[model samples]
Target: MSRPESGAPTTTPPPTPPGESPAAPLPAAGPGPGAVAVPPSPCLSKVELRVSCRALLDRDALSKSDPCVMLLMQSRGQWVEVERTEVIKRNLHPVFSKVFTIDYYFEEVQKLRFEVFDINSSSVPCGPREDDFLGAAECTLGQIVSHKKITKPLVLKHGKHAGKSTITIIAEELSGNNNYVELFFSARKLDDKDLFSKSDPFLEIHKLDDDDTFQLVHRSEVIKNNLNPVWAPFTISINSLCSCNYDRLIKDQPGVALWDRGASLGRDVPHADEDLASGPVDGCG
Candidate 1:
């Protein structure tokens, strides 16, 4: 090739082939080497949970703990109990055969809690409060679904046996179905505590919260001068009702409370008693 003057322009590259086009340019480099790549979590439909305990603190004075597991889910800023396992008598290491089924929403951060209690007397039906406290564990559903299985130690921190024992957790995902519930309730022969021999009464339904306190979920209209009252029918999603668990307790308070007024029951008006009867109906109809 002959030498060109310094002012002369350089030669252009050759054109593309007849059928093929020019190669596209590569993209610019991303962030520096410090940038890390994260894998996306899998979306799951449902999950199954199996609970087991080891070296759990025995609440009973003279016998091994009859341990049972209770599962709770967080919803609406409150943790609601959903399921429970039957007590395994006198076994420090109890493998609950009862598998709990819960719907897993990948988009939502579903928080879960587990509590173990020691049953002193299996002959009688008692609430969690009556049962002896053993220990508890907490985690999110996504954590289990992502890993497919998780085992964690349970921590005990209460009473004279505080820091005395601990437990473990095991979880797995499974198929699930959409759950719903229809509820009906009625009261009979409610005591009339008013001075006029008749009282305005309404029903207040409460669901148990994580703090072992009852949170009001629903309320019925006030029925005037009626000893017997029937509430209107209603339907609710299982998640909203009790996180799809039926073993949880649903509390009902039936009485009249004058909030705006100065007088109130058990406060200014001395002690008084009232009896109300209520139960769930068989079906939505």
Candidate 2:
């Protein structure tokens, strides 16, 4: 290029910087130097401990007169019970539908079981042998495992100290034979999986007495797999079937106080006379 005369100025653009590519955008963020990504929290596994007259029993022939729901867990090594207190009194006009929710804190769950006992006839057989005057008892029991909703086994992760999960039991009497059921729960790792096996869980129940003292009325060990933990669910009933006799005592002593008087029952003991019947149930049907 030639320069003009005295007043003319020379003009030229500066060169582009080295290492700068005109066509390329800045590189997006990539993995940091030797940094590992953290894994996500594991999803919990759950099962609907469902029981229905339609699913388990014949409904058309069932009767409301014998409406019932009974829950039992195998605690320690014995069978302890949990029954509906209302159903015990409403033998003649029982409520048909009932449900309960149970949560699991991952551990040993002996067994979780449900029983629909018939009390219409005092002679109705109940229990495992089903040959007692208590009534007829039918039940379902099992352990917790991966279902269609949960394929990957529930994990407790390396840093997790404990795991908790809940199950909701919904029941509609529909016709008769009051529906009863429970969530039989247990836990395990994905690598070492056991299916439909039992888990042993523990529970404790304390009842307050009239003397303002707390007493242990029942102790359970492990019923089966989530079957029953001697310590957890305590079945108690105060029926008025023979209260007329106790009424005579109530008349003699105003404000008659009959409380739970017994030694501390442990999860290993199924039933002990120490867990005595306080007095009598004092309500009208």
lDDT of 2 at 239: 15
Weakest lDDT window of 10 consecutive positions for candidate 2 = 147-156
- The CA lDDT at 92 in model 1 is 80
Candidate 1 local Cα displacement, residue 135, angstroms: 0.8
lDDT of 1 at 173: 42
1-285 per-residue lDDT for model 2 (tens digits): 855567444444345589974543333355668899886654332222322221122122443223344566677866678544223222332222233333333343436554444333443344322321122222223233322111111112342311221122322111212223221222222111114453333222333333443333223343334332222323322211111234532343212111121222232122122121223223212
Name the regions of candidate 2 deviating beyond 4 angstroms.
1-50, 55-65, 85-96, 121-285
TM-score versus the correct structure, for each prediction: 0.43, 0.25
Q: Which stretches of candidate 1 lie over 4 Å from their true place?
A: 1-44, 122-124, 157-164, 175-285
Residues 1-285 of candidate 1 have per-residue lDDT tens digits of 977567544455467689988754343455557888776875666566656677887677776667778899988989899998766666787656456778877788899988888765442355755447677777898887776456666666643333545544444443243666677666556666667556555554445544454433444444556666666776644544454445663333212221111113221111112334334422224
